[model samples]
Target: MINLYPVLKPFLMAVEPEAAHRAALGLLKSGLAPRYRHDDAALRCEVFGHVFANPLGLAAGFDKDAEVIAPMLRMGFGFVEAGTVTPLAQEGNPAPRLFRDVKNKSIINRLGFPGRGLEYFVAQVSDFRVAQGAGAAADGMLGINIGINKETASAFEDYSRCLSALAPMADYIVVNVSSPNTPGLRDLQSENMLDALLAGLMAVLNSLDIPPVARPVLLLKVAPDLTSDQRAAVAQLALRHHIGGLVVSNTTVARPEMLAPHLREEAGGLSGALLKDHACAVLGDFYRLTDGRLPLIGVGGISSAEDAWQRIRAGASLVQVYTGLIYEGPALVPDILRGLTARVRAAGMAHISEAVGADIDLAAPRAEAAA
Candidate 1:
């Protein structure tokens, strides 16, 4: 094994950004094909009501159709989440919709929510995971990230329909109220809107109520653009209605300090190192406000193990990455898991949860209170 990544970077990054991503995913799928991913790294941890080999995972949008999910899991993620799949398949915004910021190690994507419809993705994904068995990569937790159509008024219904269909085959379900590309989707984060959306969706989930064995988790993903007040409101609301928990802070619409380039004019969400602070702030607010009452899954500009640690301490029980995987490639997985273990040891904690919120509000007594 030759890591041709160094040789491939300049040429790949030199091309159109979205093309580069397609190329990279093609390579990852072929190089670490589904059948060969079992032994890359044994990085497991327990989260989302199941056991994960490690806290590292590929975020939604990476495997839009769920075609390569098994390979992503095999590639060494403690787990993997796929899709923002709608009731109908859409082509997404338009090509040239994804861009790379070489200097910041970031990616700007307005790809919209392109993917095959819920039924198609669910059929394939269900059969795929069930094929994994009692002890296999498929045995590791599998989360289905669901969203509504870009042009649908039935937003709430769409989420339920998808969840009801996919939940049977899923280990967890994420209610994606945050992707910046979708119009009014982020609005669902408002307390009133979120309450109804979750209430309706939960009604559907409740109808499917299978007792004894664990039901697929229902997670709410929020935007990074939310104000401090909104962050607290989200946690409070989740607790109020008992939404499965929260996936704090999705790709941000805000741009941090940047390179002097025309790409700055590109519309869409920016993710990667630039997103770290806003995400941490949101997570910290949620931690302090919720007192870690609601389980949190962190997603924002995560590019390294240290970043994972930051989110964990800020109150995330687990973390997900998308942009970092684009810039750094699949090798980034094991690197993050190894780094997480090292950081966990440095903090003198036996389990990762002990480190959750370890640094956030540390001076406030409660942050250090968890540790």
Candidate 2:
């Protein structure tokens, strides 16, 4: 394990962010990406009815079309969430939609879930499933992240269609209604809309010919910017609907004063280092609001072991990373896991779960009183 990113970052970063992303994925798909090994068992986590070898996962945007899943898993991720796959193929936002704030180690992108249509997506995962059964990386948990097509008038229809076709192959399914890139997408996160969307998707799952035990776990990806009322309401809805878990956040639309002016001007969701505090605060809020009843997968701003440990203590059962990889490279995963193990041992916890929400006082002050 040589950390190749330092040597590669200059060339990679010099290219347009989006192209560099594609190139990185291509390298990964071609088995040319660097690999790291982690034998630590302390970081194992059980969430959403599946056991993850570790809490770290590759977030959805990195492999939007389900490519490089095995490569990613082999690289030592406990799991890989694939797609914000829509009902139809989409071009997403125009070129230059992705921007890097090297100074702040953040990214702003309005990539509106551009992906090959569900049919193609299914074909790819179907191949993966088949290969998995035939001695591929069976230990790797695969989650399918579903979303509505940009032009779809009925969000429910698009979600239902995606679930009906892809759920059987997914260990869990994420209904992504929080992306800010698509117009009106965040509207679905509203209490009424979110409930309807989730309920409809669940009904579709239930109606399937498969046994109840066979249905994939359903999770929701929410915005980081939700108000307190919204957080509580969504938490209630998630519990009411028996949603399996929540991906604590998508990216943020708000630009902090810390961002460089040029990067701040970009119009899209912001992710990376800048998102750490905001993402953890939201995770802590949801953990408290849900009363620790619901499992949470924390995403955003986690670039190191300490960051992952903080989120775990803040109440995320598992954590994910995307932009951090853009900055820190694959070695980040091993480093995080090592750090988590150290933290767990230092905290006198045998398992990482014992650390979940261990520091409620340290969590961001509640949006309303009483954190």
Q: Write the per-residue lDDT of candidate 2 for residues 65-154, one digit (tens) a residue.
A: 998888888788899999989999989988889988999999999989999889899998988888888996546899999998889878
Q: Which parts of model 2 have CA positions greater than 4 angstroms off?
A: 361-371
Query: What residue pairs clash in candidate 2, if any at all?
Result: 305-336, 313-357
- lDDT accuracy of residue 305 in candidate 2: 91
Best by TM-score: 2
lDDT of each residue in 1-371, candidate 1, tens digit only: 23566678788878887777678778766744322132322235566668776777788888878877766777667678888789899888978798777778777889999888887897778667666863443445688899989889788878978988887787788899999898888898898998888788878887895652657878888887887667767778788777667887788887666732766788998888788777877777777778767777888888988888888888888889988876776667767877877776777777777887776663475334321
User: Could you tell me every candidate's TM-score relative to the true structure?
Assistant: 0.91, 0.96
Worst 10 residues of 2 by lDDT: 362-371
Collision pairs in model 1: 43-53, 43-54, 44-52, 44-53, 44-54, 45-52, 45-53, 313-357
The local lDDT score (0 to 100) that residue 41 gets in candidate 2 is: 69
Model 1 bad stretches (over 4 Å): 31-44, 134-138, 362-371
